[model samples]
Structure formats: C-alpha cells, structure tokens
Target chain A: MNKIFEVPLYAYERSSDQDAATAVRHKVIVIGAGPVGLATAIDLAQQGVEVVVLDDNDKVSFGSRAICFSQRTLDIADRLGAGSPMVDKGVQWNVGKVFFDNRQVYEFNLQPDTGYANPAFINLQQYYFENALVDRVRQLQAAGAPIEIRGRNKVEAIGTHDSHVVLEVETPEGPYNVEADWLIACDGANSPTRRMLGLDFDGRVFEDNFLIADVVMEADFPTERWFWFDPPFNRGQSALLHKQPDNVWRIDLQLGWDIDKEREKRPENVIPRLKAMLGEDVDFDLEWVSIYTFQCRRMERFRHGRVLFAGDSAHQVSPFGAMGANSGIQDADNLCWKLKLVLDGKAPEILLDSYSRERVQAADANIAKSSRSTDFITPKSQISRLLRDAVLDLSEHFEFARPLVNSGRLSTPCTYQDSSLSSADALNGPDITRPGSACPDAPLGDEFLLPKLAGKFTLLTIDAGAPERIEEGGVEATRLALSVKDDLTLELKRRYLGDATGAVYLIRPDQHVAARRDTFEENAFRQAIRRATGKE
Target chain B: MADLILTPNLDSADDFYAGLLAAHDGLDKSASDALNARLVLVLANHIGDADVLTQAVKAAALRGS
Candidate 1:
C-alpha cells in the first residue's frame, strides 16, 4: 500500500481522458449522489484520493427534504469549503414560535455561538444545496480524480471479496463491472446497498403521516417557523409553516395516523388543509404537495467489511429536529477521513471498525434524540399529550419553561459519551470533557466563527507545554493557553486563546473530540495520534 | 401564428376556483360545493393534460351533483 500523503488525486487514472469503461480502478467508490455522498466524495477528493461517484438520477430534483441546516452541519460544510456560500444563501433562524390553543405559548431564542462554528440553524432548498455539491463534484471530476457520475446507472449487485468490492452496474448503454478498495452507501432510507449487504435496519415506524407542501405566498408572512397544536381550522391535527428562500413557504400538516394510500392523488384532500392554516383571503400558488410517513429506525450496523453506510441508508430519523440528513452528512464527514487513512495504508483495519462503532453509537443516540423529539411534537399516548400540553401552559409564566415549549435541545448534536471508541480516562478529568460535547462555534477574533476544524486532524490543549512536548515526540499538536474562569465552559477571550485546564484534547476531522488526556504521560501522545489518524 | 395572449385576471378568477382553494384552506364540504362548478371550469382551462382535465371537471361536478 502506498503512503496516504503520496496518494495522488487521480492515482489510478493519469488524467480524465479515458472513458469510464477504460478508466482505471479508483481508491473509493461512493454510491448515491446526495449531500452525504457528495460531501464524502469532496472530502476524499480534497485529500488527493481517486474517487468515482454513481447515482441513478440524471439530474438533481427539487424537494422539500432536509431544509434546516444546523450550525453543526454548517461547521462541517465549512470544513469542506462551501460554508460561506450556504450561509449567504440560507435564512439564519435563531428564534422559533410554538402556539398552543391557537396562542403563542413559548418563544425560543437559541444560544448561538455556544457550540461549534455557525449559528443555531439556516434554511435553504435541498435542491440548491445539491446543485452546489454537484458543481463541486464536477470540479473534482475536472481535476482528473476520475469521479464518473454514472447518472441513470443503477448498481445491480455488489459483491465483496478479500481485496475489493465489485459493483455490477446497469447503465443506459450496457452493464459494466467496477471494483474498488472501498464502497460508501449514502443511498437514503430505502438503501438497496444496505439490503444487498443483508444489514438489519430495525426500529419503530411512527403511524402518523405528514403532508408537506411548498407554496408561493402573495401576502407578507412572518419569517420565523411557526408550530401550532390543535389549530382552529384543523382539529386533532397540527400545522407547521417555515419561510424558505424566494417567496416559497414550507407548510407541514400532521395528517392522522391512518392515511389512504391514494390520498395524495386527490389534490383536493390536501389543498383544504393548506387553506385552513393560511387564511382563505391569502392568495398562494402551490409548487408541490406530497404525503410522507415519518419513520424512526436505524441499521443494526453501519458496515459490512469494505461496504459502508452513511445518511438515511444507515438510519432514518423522523424529521422532528431535522436530524435525518444532518446526522447523515455528519456520518459521511466522520467516515471519509478514516477511510482515506486506511486506503492510504496509514491506519490499521481496527480503525475502520471504530467508524462503525462510534457513528453507530452516534446514530443510536440520534435515533433516541429524534424519537424523543417526535414524541414531544406528536405524542401518541394520552398521558404524554397531557404532559406536553402542561409544558405549553406552564411556559406562559416560567422563564426556563420556554425551552420546553421551544425545544432547542432537538437541534443540538448528540455526544459519544458511552461509546466503545471513547477512552474511559478522557471522561474522568478535572477539565470538562466535551467528548460528545460538540466543538463550540464560539466567535474568534472577528465575526468569523472559529473555522471548522475539518479536512485535517486538530489538537486543542490547555497545557501550554503540550505543543513543545508533542513536537519533541515527532507529533504535531496545537496548544492554546486557557485561563480557568468561574463558568464551567469554554471562554473565548479578547485574544484567540480559549479557557480551560491542563488537559490535552485531540479533535478528529469531523470535529469530534476523539481522545483527551490530562497529561500526555508514557507514550499517550503517540497512542492518541494513532487513535486519531488510525496509524497504530 | 398569432401572438398567444396569456393575459387573464388571476385575482378575481381565483375566487371562481374558491371551492378548490377553500378545500385546501381547510373549509367545510358545503362551502366547498357552492363554488365547485366554477372551480371545475376554471381549472379545466388551466390543466395541460387532457385526460387529467376530464378527471378534474368530472370529479368537481360529481361533488356538486
């Protein structure tokens, strides 16, 4: 195996001159051209790894799926080099309104810049986001990485042997076989790749179905997202409306549990629901209306040997906190860097399993968090409904009760505290370990939120002596001298330095703090470097 | 070929399709039927697919009938 650093962007194919059939075998074959697959491909291409991405669709489609891009996702995107454009295009929403009994019960102002770079959340069209990614993918393809986007090509069969995974693809022209060292599946919830591998996607399916509509409003509606319970117009149903780019409005109606399969075919059934939420006088043009069932399930495992899973392929989280695609993109971010190291022969096979372990744990935690959020939003039981209503009632007077009504916790990233990959020593320390605590998006010197620490490994330490020690041991590390303050939180001073104790923290490319040590004692730094880079 | 005039008053014309709009706006069946006949005629003019247009008028008139 070649040294990872020496691996050229298009190692197998000299240039992008050869037809895909005659093209050389790539280092990685990524299935599905969604945000996760594209993001993983972009990250791998940036690292100079030869990649080929394949999808069934000929062109990107406009859909109302995964609109809310959280600050964490923006931070991850920033590392991939498209954060600024996304931020510029998206509407930054920090406040949300929840209405109970047709009245404003709770208003939430999210604590921005508290964790990771970027804001609370931003709303953008998924199709536009896909276009941006497609452009990036095209750029990488032009650079001679052999990113053959076999649009209208479907993978018929994927067979894994000792060396590489063989993909049998049926393209418009003909059937072709392509083999690669690794395969990453970002093919969404109904992933054929996951099924081909015989991995189990087990969990409860929510009985409730939702009708999502994208409408063009003529009237001036509020920019904030509004959630209403037992809306006056529609009893036993909830209405949610969000403003998107352009004059487009995203309205979701919580249709009852049982839905006729042919309900959407009759547009009249869905149209009235939209009118009830928006006043009858308001003139609007319907862009698209579709009925979708919410499901909360995750794969038992994220990988089968060389074949791996990311996004909805791995887990299907109900869109309660917009966790489905956000978590999926994060999964791609986490898996890409590790796969690069392994393919480059920089890391052992054991490191690959950590992706499965850590991310599966993250997915499990995400599933639970999203499920809890779904239950909170649309509780099934009578007692749970009463408890939910009680919170809305109490939030009127209680200051802290607003968070319950607003529920900002849904959007927060789930940490990997009780995962096998996490070191026990790191959890017990003098300094607060944000192991699962998302890397804060605290503002740096200017208005720049601390730059996303993606693409490469990062070392953040309170010990002023650590960088010197790391350099002494032939290991690269960054030392930030932090002053321990009164609050048990990371403090960004007038300077660039942070606030904390004498502990060393190693952050992964996806911005997950992998390993933290109070003192780098007895080859701990080397072990940590191996743990982070998977070289050990 | 003459200049295809696309000019049409969409505002008041919108009220002619009030039943369809009202149905989407979460209105009851009675008010939904009152404007059904006008809704069918207005929508049939807008629909591009002939088969779909036939279905639209038939369904709307059946609801009113």
Candidate 2:
C-alpha cells in the first residue's frame, strides 16, 4: 500500500496563452521538480535567467529517499544558497562501519583531511532537501527573480529542434503549449520526455531486490553508516542501516530477486524483519516501505538538439552509494552555469555540448562505481560471492585490502579529467588543480577558496607574478602571497603551487580548473579563457 | 607497534591504476578471477601480516548457518 505524502498545494497560474496560436517563449523550461530539476531551476535563477519547473506531484519526495548528501553535494548546494538549511537540519556523519556475518570488519572515515567547511556526509531526508530548494526558489521568485515552480504541472509531449524545444504541459486547467529556448528533462528514471523522444537508455540491471524501509523511532544508534554482508538478521544477503533526520532509521535488506515484492512490502512482513534486527522489545512505526531492483544505465547522449536531459532522466544507478541524487544534483550544477552562459550569448552554443560530454562521462563513472558496490553488496555469482568474502576478510587487518571493501563507494563528484575545455598545462605544478578537476578548497583569510572563485571566471594564482593588471572575462585574477606559516595557507600552496613558488590557474565559473600555467601570458590566458568558455 | 597512517601513501597512483587495469586486459571472466586470486595471494605474502590477514578472513567468514 502506497501512502501519499501530503504537501501544501501550490496554486499555479497559467502563463501560456491557450487562445494564441504560438506559445510564450521562456529562456529555459525544466521538466520535473525533483532535486535535479529544482536544482537546475534554482541555479539558472541565481544567474538571473528566467526559468520554470514542471512536475506531476504537488508534494515533496514521499520517503526519505537519498538521505546521505555527500560533502561535494552540500558544497554545491551551499553555492546555490540552500546548503546552510540542510546542514542545519542534517545529521553530520563521516565515520562508517562495515560488517560481515554480524562481526565488525573495519571502520572508515570519509574526508579525513580537515580544516575545510563541511563534513564528509550529512543525513537529511529527501523531503527536507526538496522543500528547502523549493523555498529558496520561492524566495528568489518573491525577490522578483524570474523563477516559477508549478506543482501538478506535468509534461505530456516533447519535440526538439535545432532552434528550440516545444513542450505540451498538462495542468489542472488543461493542456497548454509552451516552447523554450532549451528544455531540460529531469523527469526521473521513467522519464516520459525521454520516452516521447524515443531515445534508448542503456545500462546493466542487477538481479537483487533491496527492501528499503524507513521507521521512525527514538533509538541510540550512532550517526554512522552500518553495512553488513550476510548479517544474522538477513542470512545469505546483505543489509544496511543508516541514520536519517527526525529519528528515522533507514534499513535496507537484500530480499533477493525471486522474493514477492508485494508481500515483502506488507507491514506484516516488514515489521517482523525490523523486529528481527532491532529486537522485539523496541517499538517503532513504519514511515515508508519500498523495494528497488538496481539498474545502472544511461542514455547515449544527454542532449538531443535543444532538449537536454539531466538527473535520472539522463542516467540512473542503484541507490546503494547515494549516487543517483548526488550525481543528478551535480548534473544540474554542471549544466545550469553553461546553459546560462549560452543563453546570455556570452559564449558559443557548443558549450552546451560539453555539458553532455562531461556529465555522460560522470554518469558512466557513477554507474561503474555504483554497480560495483551493488555487486559487492548482493553477490550474484558464486565466484563474486567468494571474492567479496575474501576481500572483506583481508580488509579486517590488512590496510591494503581495506580499499576493496565496497559499501556503495559513497558518492563523489566526477572530475572531468578528459574534458575538451581543459587547456594544455605545460607548467610544473601539483596534480590537485589539474585541468578539468574541481578546484580544491582551502582557507583564504576568513573565508574559503571556492566561494571567491565561484560565480565568475577566475584566474587564480598563488605566490606568482604580482597581478597588477588582471581582469579577463568578468573578474580579476587573485594572487595569494600569504606566508606558508599558516597551516591552511601551506595546504593551499601544497595543493595549488606545490614545491614551486607559484602557479597560475584558470578557473571556470563553476570553480573547475580550466588551465594552469607557470606564468600567465596575456594572449595565452585569453586563449585559455576562450577555450574554457567553448570559444575554441 | 606503529599506528598505521591512514593517509595516501602511494605516489604515481594514476600510473599504478592504469597498470593494474592493463594487467587484466584481454582476459575473460574466469581468467581475471584467477589473476585476482594470484595477485591477492602475492600481495598478502608481501604484506605478511598474519594477525591482520587472519582477522580479515575471520571477519568475512560465513556465519548464522
């Protein structure tokens, strides 16, 4: 039985003229109001781009889906101005414990290198995240920014062209024809937009079914990820327990592919399973019960002319490592800035092509990582099972084998190492700020490095030539000559400049390193900026 | 007894990864499996941490049978 999540109905006013033969032209129309779509909308609006989001549902996410928000996701969210609220409400956890057959094998801490802003991961319910993003979008709208989110607005049909994309949106009033300069599809795994366009979404599907249940209880479970392979509670299968906000504990039990999903989801079956794990004396109420068979698949290309696909619409993976939503959010972050640039006509339209290229590569990477996690969690073959056990066994003591332990690899942002936009770096420097990687954050006086470099094309330099005349695309280059006496300053030097005294780095608006050179010549720097913006 | 440093210890990580993958190239599933088994044994012998290896095997051993 599926219980509907109650959300305040948003009374949306229709913008398109039904009487007029032609539709109103919007700068961008984003389909689906899930994390990805909403993130895209919020990002575009932050860039002063007029954007609208359409979704079939009036409420936020039903269950506590995607509870583990990665540090990178939070960093991206904070950049979008929604990070503080989530961090405020979220359960910050970095330590994780992996078990095999009811015995603790090893404990690992993600993002051990400290002095940065955020933790490794935060466990917040998906609903809170969606609500926060929606609130931020509403705030931007109230501030007279061109952003509209229409709940109960569903995309029925989609047509793409070289010039623009057309959409038939079905609302409560009726069907309305609308057109957009570019259409972004974030309509989730079963994206009707992708189906309507007749594009193939190809990937591997695992045979195991995981029973995901969230139960509200006041328990003393520590804020850490607990993963068990063939636990006593669920024999011959794996189980995962994670702490979420509002005292809800997320329990995932591997149910095997042959189990009756309907019977498995019933309160009769679910309560016993929980009781078996948590003991019979404990009391709890089930918040959500769902079964998922994992699949790692994606479209060949995220873009088809003017229509762009993002989030689950573009690629989907097993929810083991919290990769699905995190990658989707990154997809939105990566696309929105580039889309804003192309829309503003500041750069060539080919910049949009890089969005698909980089993100498709990201999707493939996520799929590979997540699929391996899934295979480890639920071993299908005898050899796979044997290998998994061997790795887990060796992981308990040997630090070398510890890396083999895969409890969903945990979501991390993909660095576009092979990105076409990256400039050839002939300079001697550390690989930390390599072209096509997100610029590593370090303390700058009172604030962090990312916040300064974001929202502009920054030519970052540390202990390099004294930048007297700088200013290329939008902002001037930063010359950080802070003495390495400070630990943070030293870390910055080790990461960016390395053993060298100084290195000049070209950074994109998204804070990805576009190029790095020992000395920034005027012509070379200009050419690098142009290439970064898809002018090459 | 020294507390094992849990930080990055390897240099040339990218090259090592490429070599690792390249070593298994052109091999089918079973061959790759055999190779991984041989590699693990070789590495385990190289490590020679009996207590750690024992703890690891014991940790992943099948239970609740």
Candidate 3:
C-alpha cells in the first residue's frame, strides 16, 4: 500500500570481485526471490544451512499475481515464520462457484472439515506474500541465520561441474563471478539457468491467452471464487472473478487465440468487458492489467548433478487451479530438508535424487490436473465441448457428475504413492493419514499435528511406550506418546492408527509418512531413516 | 499401470448384467454389436490408461478362445 505502481530500483552494495580465481564460494545459491526460492532459502536457513538468494529484480512483483494461497502452502509458510501475517493481510476464502453460461452449475467449499488453524485458502496479493517472506528472512538473519537475499543481483551465465556449479552474476555495479556447492535454479518460466544448460519443458502448450485485470472498487462482492464457462458477460468464452485483500478484484477474461493481444489489453476493451461482467453502474478504477498464455509442462529432471530446479524453473502450469505456486512451495519444502541433510553429510547424495523424483511426480500430478481443468474450461474439440456441456447439465441435478465438472480442481498436496521414502507397510491403516500422504492436520491438545511433527523425524506412538530418541548415524528422532484416553489423541488414533491398539509411525522432516508399524520392532526406526534417506 | 479388476468393483454385478442383457434382448446381432462397440469406447476413454485398456482389449479378444 505504501508504494502504488512505482517500480523502484534496488540498491545493493557491489560485492563483485573482479578476480575470477578468488570468487567466494557459497554452500547453496538460490536464484529467484519469488515464493519458491524464498521458501527454500527460509527452510534451509531455519535448518542452519548457509543459503543465499539471488533475484534479478529489486522491487516486489507489481501485480496481484498468484492470489490464491492453498492451506498446504500456508502450513509451509507458517513453518517459515510468515503464516500469521499472511493470514492477517490476506482475504480468506474457501467456497467456489462454477457457472455454466448464465446459470450456476457447481459450488464447493474446499474445506468442510474445520478446526485447523489456517483456512482452506487465502486470497493474498503476491507482493504482500513476498514482503512477509522478506521480513521473516530479515528477522532470521538478525537472529544469526546465514541467509542472504541479494536483489538486483542478476545471474548472467552458469557453469555446472561435478564438484561445484559456477554462476556469473550481473549487478548495477558490474558483472562478477561466484560459485556454489549447489545452485538452486528458481529463476522462473524463462529460466536462464535451464536455458543455459539446454533444457526444454515436455508437456501441453496451451493456445489461448488470458487477459488478467485487477480493478479497485468499493462494490460488495462475496469472498468466493466465481468462475464462468461461456459467461453471459463475454459470450462463448470463460471468465473468472476473485476478490483480493485490498478492495482490488482480479478478473481474468479468456481471450481466444484469434484476438489481438494489444487490442485486448487496452483499457477501452477491458473496461467494456468488466462493465458487462459487473453492470455499468458500478464505478471502479483499473489497478493493473496483463496478458498471459501458459503451458502445462515441466523439465523431465529437476535435479542435474550439482544444479537443481524448483518452482517455475522446473515446471509451468495453467492458472485455472492455482497449482503452480503451491506446488512450487511444496518443491521447496520437499527439497530443503533433503538438501540440508546432504549438505550436513547426514544422508547420501542419492537423497537429493528423491527431491527430483518426488517433485517431478508432484509436477506431473499438477500438470495433469491443471491441464484437464484448462481443457474443461476451454474445450479444444467439438466433442470435448459437447461433453463438457453435458457434464454441466448433469451436474445440476446429479451428485455423481459434480466431481467430474472441472473448473480447476484447486490444488491439493500431491501424495507420493510410489515415493522411495515411503516405507512398504503390509499392515493396513486409515487412508486419511497413511503412508506417502502429508500428515493430516488434527486439532492436537494445544497445537496441530503438522506443526508438532515438522522439522524432525517424529515417531507418533498410540497407546504404547514410545522409543527413546535415538540420535545415531547423523539422524535425530523424537518420539511422542499418545493415549486413547485423551480426546485429541483419540481423534489422532481414529484418523491415523484406525483400530490398531499399539502402533508406531515414522514421520519425515517434511511431515511425510516414512513408515508405519503395528508392533515396535527393533532397529525399525533407524532402518526407516536409512530407507527414507535412500542409504539402505 | 491400472488396478487389475478386483472383487466388489460394482455394488450389484447381477443387476447390472441383468440390465445389460435386457437392453439387448430384442435387438438384432448387428445393433447389439454396435452398442457393445460404443460401450467399449466410452469405458476405454473413462479408464484413460492406454496400457491397461490395450491389455483389456487383448483379454476380451482371447476370452473363451
């Protein structure tokens, strides 16, 4: 709010050592200060890893880009120390209504089960989210965390080797050379790092472009995600309206492939579309407008020797589901712990391989889901459109067809079903908090299950004497005993343990299930650690 | 890989088969075959797994042979 639409230059003292031979080597250098990179830096710094972030741009993103922050992402942000402020500044929303032509076809509340601290979703401007992250990073830095965020420090060239990766950075001062033991390329969709290494995304490239306009108005619009397929306002085209934090509303109009980009983006053209969507009587001032065409694609491999990719650097998706940023945040969460352990020499470097493996799977899941939403929203074929309309018609009366009606199946955490880290357990458990799924957030005695389990290998025991925390082989584990007598523990048992009287659950640092056991077996804890880290 | 067709896939297999048989009871062989063809295509598209669908087609082609 302090600076409205003013893109200012960032001032960073030049640290470019002209001598290439004496360039300072960093432990981890993360490119891009967007949510994904900042999340990675924060996670690594929280774990005591010396991490530095390099962003080409100095100012916060101007537009209200990536407004829908999912609950899973908010949980991750909470761990990063920016969750509370984000919730305070964001417009919390959960319900979404999908309209077909002029009639409402489907409506859904992302969260029907409540009691979790964070809401199902929050509509926060990307700028505020980034600022909160920056503030958190500053606080951590002040508290002796070795995290450096260098804005206006643009990466010029990259060199990857077996031992280390070299990054040539450019600043207002001049171009300089630096190297890192590990370089995280979060440089976004047009990733210079990915291009430098000669990589390409392999997936669907969408044809249609979308015109996104953020309008500021005092009009009363319910805090619900309103999506339209062949909306009345813009005939035969899809439109979406979302309410943001500052009376600014985001309206995304689907511009067909044939439309001129220049003409479509003009305020004259956009305002008419807005007046149609929202009657001409409403007064509003245009805040920001941009055009975007997205592809549902990802790099086949997120990890390349000493270099790694996260966020838009690794994958890009259609915005219908808001999966891009959330999945990228998950990538950072999934990567940081593995990177930390490997950097500490606690886990085999193969552990880093799992980062690419798990994240690629997550990326594919996002791409698949997002692509389907895009297809359903903008049917590519006559048959597809007919089928979409049929589904819309059926969804009005039939409950079964509602799930099939896809207007962006809003992002949910990708459960790694085939993850190597997830232990192969024969014993059955409740599907709610099973292996490979993120630990379901339950209202624990005081806090929640996720916050209690994160940052360490936790052994959640039910109605059993918990094992002593065995810190061996560079592994640290804590065991928490839960009794069925306590209400919260009973709920935990119902969700996690099911009918098992005495059970042991091995949870990873990222709160992903590693292993579950009915009987406490000797060496199971350490073995789970070994399997999780891919050392076994 | 798709999940191999397991037990209890449908709540009432008997009722569904009864309805299927009734639907084709009065139809000619050509019309019944056409119906079967449409059914196969629709179910195949819903399954969406090419490998499993191919295996299924192979399995169906070899049934009772």
Candidate 4:
C-alpha cells in the first residue's frame, strides 16, 4: 500500500588525513546551516570574528518552508549584501484578497507610507534563501575572514567554561571537540542544543493538519494573493492558493477532522482534485506536497551561560503569517551586535542577559500573533466559525469594522514590557514609543528613516540640547533632527515636544530604543544608559 | 429594449471568471478601465492560483507599508 522512497543526501564530505579532533578555537560556533544560522555566521564573519558553522543536513532542502520575507528582513539582507540577488529571484507582492464562503470580504494593498527602502513583503523559497546565505558565507571565507562549514557534523554536546564553550561535534570520522567564545544554536524547532542544556520549549501544538502543495502550472494568474473560506475544494475543507515565479504556485488545503485517520494520500486523490478545480486541460505537475501540524511555543530562556539559542531554537510560530522565520531573523539582527560587543570586550558579560530578556519578549509576541493567525484560519468550533462569519459581514458594511476584520495589528513590532532594562514609567504603562521599543522608521531627506539608523545605535530626542546633556550623563548619544513622514507629509520634528527636552533616549545597536527620557536630566539619562548597556 | 435571458446551473468559479471576462468585453471596455478590471481579476486569479497564496497573505500583513 506504500512505496519506499530514499532521498539522496546532498551534504559535502571531505577526505582528511589530518587529526579531526584537534581542538580549534573559534570566536563563534554556529550550529545549523539554515537561513538564520547562516545569516548569523555571515554577520560574525563580516565583523572579523572567527566562525564555524555545522549542520547535519547534506544540502539545502527544497521546500516552501519560509517563502515570505518582510520589508525589515529585506533591509537586513541588503545590509549583508545579499538583498540584490535575492530580490532578483523573489517576487514582490503588496496586495491580498480574503474570501469567506465564496464571497470577498476583506482586501489589503500594502501602500507603505513609512517610506522603507524595501516594500512590504517579498516571496522566495527557503532553499534559495539558504543557498544565497551559504554563498555569502563562502565569499567571506575566501576573503580570509574564514568560516569553517562542516556539513555532515552534528553538534553532540556543548559545555560552557569561564572563557569558552567546549563543543563535542559528531562527524563521520567520530566525535571531535572544538572550542568557541560563544555557541549560537540556530539548529531549529527540535534543537538538540537546547535539549542538551535542558532548556524547555513551552507552548501548544495545534491538532489540525495542513496539506501544502507546490505545483507548476501554465495558467494566467494574478500577482495578488487570495484566501478562501469553506471552499468546496475538498468538500467542507478550506483551501488557499498563491502565485509564485517560474510558473510555480502554492496551494494549501485544510484536511478536515472527518478525513480518514490513516488515509493513504496517493497522487490519485490529489491530482483529480486539482483537475476538477482548474480543469483537466490545464498543464501542471505537483512539485512537492507535505502535511504539517502547527505549533506556538517559546523557550523559557534564550541564553544558558555562553551558549545562546536563536530562531526556532528560541521560538516556534505557526506558519500563518510566515512569522517564524522572519522573527528568527529579527532575533539574529538583535543579538548579533550585542554578541559582537561582548566578544570584543567593549561590553561586560551582563549585557548577554538583555538578549534573553528582549528576544524572549519578541518571541512571545510573534508566537501570539502567529497563533492568532492560525486560529483565524482554522476555526476550531462551529461557534467560532459563526462568530468569524458575522464579523466578516459586519466589516463589509461598516467603515469602523475594517480593522477588526483585517486584524492588521499583528504585524507591528511587539513592545517589550517584562524586560528588566526599561524604566519604571515604561514598564508601568502601555506606551507606543517607549524605552525598549523598536524605534519606528523616521523620514530622512528622501529615504525612509531606517536607512540612516543602520550599523549603529541612534538616539533621537526632542530637546535640541539633550545630546550634550546625555554626554554629561555619561551616555553616548547622537543628536538627529529626524523628520517622520505621516500620511504622505513629513512631520519635520519630534512627535512630542518640550517635556521630552533634555529627555535622553538611548538606542541599541539593533535600533531598538534602549532607554528614553521624558525630561532631560543628566543622572536619569546616565542611569538609563547604564541599564540599557548592562553597565548597571 | 433588452431581452431577459436566464441561464441556470452556473456554479464553477472558472466559469464565473470566464463569464465575468466576457461580460466586460461585451461592454467594449476602455483600456484604462480594462486594466483596472484586469488588475482586480488577475489578482483574484492569483489568490486562487494555489502555490503562492500563503506567502502573499504574509506579505500583505507586513507593517508600515
């Protein structure tokens, strides 16, 4: 009743007569050759840090694992010089349509007024993304900024000593011990690194199974996106379709609970359904089809001694918003600078704790958003479905009901509340632009505000004299006259005035507001700066 | 005077799209008007295309433009 299929391993193997166990010390040892791990490795290598990347997989697995990248991620990739080629291979999309029971209910076109260099989202398969990042890693290696990539080597154990983390990696030749200043585990959802350290990934796994199908078809399709509700694609099941480049498209069908528990999913059951939908005359072949159960979870802590966890190792989001990979990349972007500062001895070890605090906040927020998206997509009960349909109906008629229907709040960066770094005022209340918040993009000349904030931490204050006061407060601050574009008009001053004068704002390397001031006072600014940098 | 002709049993989505396209052409649609119509229609087709929809949804959800 089943056919045996053996997928060939595409990992690279080398014949080495040299001693394999010769302990080599690296500034950073990244475990995982996936996009996040590779992105981390490239950032470290670019900063002149010695690096090594190891993965169990032989080569990049072709799949629609993480096909959607955010504008923020595109900017990050641009900074690393991988954006151009990636953008070439990917499709830029900004429009979407949602159909509820064969009736169009909601629509959104990404008319980004925030003025970011990149558009709202770009689509590219996970495999091509990994290839691009791996290629970047190799380019860095060729430039003498060496990165040792061990494809077949799987990390077995990691022990952090006072100065270094000792890693026992299992290779074909046997187990080999290596040392690194820091060990980053981007290994993935079931991270062996996190398990080895006894870190618990606490969360919930959805009971539903989603069938993802990638097909190559010669049909004239729109460049926009559509999601159908309770469509008769599979009879009482929901289905989703999207257009991709290279004549390929992605399809997802909700396999309802009534499906045979042990149903044999032959090509016969799938192809006929496709033929029925698009007509049998349409030429197409199923490229890949897989079923995945979603999960929403985050680790108790992202850091254990010197070994750190990032990406899926830190948090797992449902595939609903493509939040998992995007959030993971954001984690890498946040942690890279702090790790660099600590490794270079520019900052103390206490700074590492902020990584856990801030990223865990982000991880939690992403999980919540993705979970909500998953819930919205797969209504668990009849009541839930009824409520959803009612809301959709309301949205169509009432102007005030659109936000409730669209649910666009999930896309905003999460404001950190539980982190120890924020001021009492920030932690005590809900404020949009507070300390520990991701400073929203400001307009600069013709470009959106973020391009100017690249590479270094920036502090934007309303009090023109606050930059000098911050210096006196023992904090490093760069005063900028930031013009934020609001509704096609550039507001050429700080959003708040007067009281924020001399109110010091400290920004982190990741451009998050590390600390902020409502009143320009030297001691308070100093204390906030110290807290942000972990000098306190 | 317009003749009222009713056709029954039209259910398929593809058939609907074809009927919609034909009706637009029957009106002798202008190029700019046709472009806007095609934009919406094509986008609808893409949404129903089956390969890229989920990514499109995520992309559509992006913050701040």
Candidate 1 regions exceeding 4 Å error are: A1-24, A108-117, A142-146, A205-207, A406-409, A424-433, A447-452, A467-490, A493-503, A518-522, A533-536, B1-65
What is the iRMSD in Å for candidate 1? Answer: 20.3
Q: Model 2 over residues A1-536: C-alpha lDDT tens digits?
A: 43334655355666555456778788899888888999999999999999988888788888887888987888888888898899999987677888898688999887666656766778888888988898898788889999987877888888777888888888888988888898999998889998999999886555468899998887676778788888888998888888887788999888887888899989988888788777798888898899877667899999888989999888888777889899999888888888887887777888889999999999888888877887887777888886778788777777777777787778877788788888887577787678888877776667676777766677676656645445556434554443444445567777777777667777877778888887767788877777877888
* Shift in Å, residue A153, candidate 2: 1.1
Worst 10-residue lDDT window, candidate 2 chain A = A475-484
Estimate candidate 2's alpha-carbon lDDT, on a 0 to 1 scale. Answer: 0.80
Angstrom error at residue A61, model 1: 3.3
Q: Show pairs that collide, candidate 3.
A: none
lDDT tens digits, residues A1-536, model 4? 32111232335565241265478777888999888998888877777777888888667755666777876677777766677677788886668776666567777787755545566677877777777786777677788886767778877888879778988877777777888889999999889998888778886655456677788887676677766766555655566676665767787777754455335256877787677555668888898887765567788888888888999888887666677778788778777877877776666787888888888888777766665655556666655555555555555555444554423232455566556666555222125456666656544556555555555555655433454324422335566543223314433234322223234456665666666655456677667666666676
Cα deviation in Å at residue A146, candidate 3?
0.6
lDDT of 1 by residue, A1-536 (tens): 53221222221222232346552466888888888988888888888888877777655544556688887788877777777777788886656778776778767766565533466678887765776677677776787764556566688898887778888877656667777888889898889998787778887655467778888886887788888877776566677888888778898777777767476536687677677777787789887777777577787778788888998888886666777778877887778877877776666776777778778877777777766666667767765666566666656656644555533244556576654444445534533345545566544434343463555556665533555335312335554444334223444322223332466666666666667766555367567666565454
Off by over 4 Å in 4: A1-21, A106-108, A159-163, A172-174, A235-237, A256-265, A276-281, A395-402, A406-411, A424-432, A446-448, A461-463, A466-504, A518-522, B1-65
TM-score of chain A of each: 0.86, 0.93, 0.95, 0.84
The candidate with the higher TM-score, 2 or 4, is 2
Q: Report lDDT per candidate.
A: 0.67, 0.80, 0.82, 0.67
TM-score, chain B, model 4, is: 0.28
List, residue by residue over B1-65, the lDDT tens digit for candidate 2: 32333467779889989999999999998668766875775566676677766665665584886
Q: Rank the models by TM-score, top first.
A: 3, 2, 1, 4
DockQ of each: 0.01, 0.06, 0.07, 0.02
- Model 1 interface CAPRI class: incorrect
Cα lDDT, model 2, residue A471 = 57
Alpha-carbon DockQ of candidate 3: 0.07
On residues A450-479, what C-alpha lDDT tens digit does candidate 3 reach at each position?
787878888888776666686657887788
Error of 4 at B19 (Å): 40
Top DockQ hit: 3
